[model samples]
Target: MTTPPFPAPTTAELAVVSAQLGRTARGVVGIAARCECGNPTVVATTPRLPDGTPFPTFYYLTHPAATAAMSTLEATQVMPELSALLAEDDGVAAAYLAAHEAYLADRAQFGEVSEIDGISAGGMPSRVKCLHALAGHALAAGPGVNPIGDAALERSTWSPEKCRCDDPGAALRDVEASTA
Candidate 1:
C-alpha cells in the first residue's frame, strides 16, 4: 500500500517548537539545527557502555517550509484550516489529540533510552533514523485518524550495539559550541 504523507508544522510553529527544544537541549548533550526548510534538527550522540558498545540517535521537527513542501500546500492556508477543523469538529479534534499523544509517547521513549544508556554519533541509529521513524509514523497515522497503532514503532528504537561514541556529552558540547 502507498503510504500517505505527514502533516507539517508552519514556519512560525516550527520556530516556536525549535526554540523550546533549544532551551531544553541547552546544557545537555544535544545540538539543534535549523534547516532551510524551517525544520529543527536535533542530534544526540551516545556514550559507550562498559562493554564498549554504542547507541546514537537523531531527531527532526517539521518546519513550516518542509511541511508545506511535503504537502504541496501553503502553510498559511493549511495551519488556519487545521485549526478551524479542530474547532469545528469534535472527531477531528480527537484525532489530532490522539496523534499528539502518540508523538509524545514515542519521543519520551526515545529520550528515556538515550538518557539511560546514551547514544553514539559515529554509527547506526543516527539522527536520520529517528527523524525518519517519526515522520513515517506521523504519515502513517495521517490526519483525523484516531488511536494510532504502534506497529513499526520499535524500528526507530536505538540500541548500544548500533553506536560508536566514547562520550556523548563531549560530542554534544562540541556540536553546540560550534553551532553557537
Candidate 2:
C-alpha cells in the first residue's frame, strides 16, 4: 500500500495557499513542497475533494512566481519543443511514463477516484499539456522523477531556491493569529 504524502496542512498554510490561488483551496492534503522561505510551492491535493469533485492534479503548484514562470514557458512555444523531444527520446518517454505511474500511485494512497484513476496531470505519459502541473510534480517528487517536469523547470526562469512571495511568512502568521 502506498503511503499518503502528508498528514494535513496547518491553518496558516491553507490560508497562504488560498491567497496564492485566489480561492479557498479545496482538496489540499498537505504542503508537498515549500520554498526556501517556508512558503508553500507545491501542494498535495487529494484525489477527491471535500465537495466530491474528482481532482486529478495531485501536486498543485501554488507559488505565484513559479506558476508565472511555467505560464511563460507554456506561452513561449515550449510545449511543442518538449513534445518533440518526448517523441524522439526513448529515455524521456519511458521516464515520463514512469512518472505518470508514480503520480497515480501517490494519489491512490489517499482514495480512489474512478473518474481520474488513470489520469495524471500535465498530459503525462504521452504529451506535454500544462507546464504548471509538470513543474508542480517536479517540485513535489524532486529531480529525476519526472523528466518532462524537470525539463520544464530547467526551461523556466523561476527558482525555488529564492522567496518571491509578496509578504512571505509574517503576513500569513499575522492573519492566522488574528483569526485565532
Candidate 3:
C-alpha cells in the first residue's frame, strides 16, 4: 500500500503554531518581575496555542504599584464609553461602540503607562504591541459590523482633472456619468 502524502502547513497555520510554542516556552520560564514594595509583579506572556487557541494560563503576581497604575488608567480611559454603550438600546451598535471605546481605552492606558522594553516595530513598546494584538483579536472575535465609508474619508475630496463640456445636456450627461 502507498503512503498518503502529508499536507503542507499554510503560513497562518505556521504562525499560530509558532506563537503557541513561544507562549508555552515563556510560561515554562516562569516570567515574573519584582515590585518596589517587595511584592512579586505579575508577568504574563499570553501566547496562542496551535490552531489559534488562546492559552488558558496566566501568570499571577502581586505588584500593588503596577495594579494601582493599571486601575487608574482603566478608570480614566475605558469607563466612560463603556457606560455610554451600556445605556444604548441597539445591541449591535452598543457592541461596536463598546469595542471602539475599549480599543481607545487600552490604547490610552497602555500608551501612557507602559514603556517599550526592547526594539519593536513602528517604535511602539511591547505593551502597546500587545494592546494592538488584543485589539485585533477583539475585532476579529467580536460580534459587530464594521462601519463603511471611513477609508474614503482619508483621501482628498476633489480631483484636479478639467471638465470640457459647454452644452447643458453634455454637462448633465457628464454629471450622470460621474455619479454613476
Say which candidate scores most in lDDT: 2
- Backbone clashes in each candidate structure, one number apiece? 11, 0, 0
Predicted structure with the largest TM-score when compared to the true one: 2
lDDT of 3 by residue, 1-180 (tens): 221112233333223223323432332222233223212233333333335444322222223233343344344554343334334536534444544444333233222222322222111211111222222223222324211111111121211122111231333234345556
Query: TM-score of model 2 relative to the true fold?
Result: 0.94
The positional error of residue 152 in candidate 1, measured at the CA in angstroms, is: 22
Kindly list the per-residue Cα lDDT of model 2 for residues 95-176, writing each as its tens digit.
Answer: 9999999998888888998888799999999999999999999999999999999999998898888777776666567767
lDDT of 1 by residue, 1-180 (tens): 222122333334333444544443211123233332322333322233234443323233323333323233222243344345456777655654655554434334334453534332111121112223233334334323322212122222322223322333343344455556
What's the TM-score of every candidate structure? Answer: 0.31, 0.94, 0.23
Please report how far candidate 2 places residue 90 from its true position, in Å. 0.1
Regions of model 2 farther than 4 Å from truth: none
lDDT (CA) per prediction: 0.34, 0.90, 0.29
Rank the candidate models, highest lDDT first.
2, 1, 3
How accurate locally is residue 58 in candidate 3, as Cα lDDT from 0 to 100?
28
Give stretches of model 1 more than 4 Å off. 1-72, 112-137, 140-180
Clashing pairs in 2: none
Ranking by TM-score: 2, 1, 3
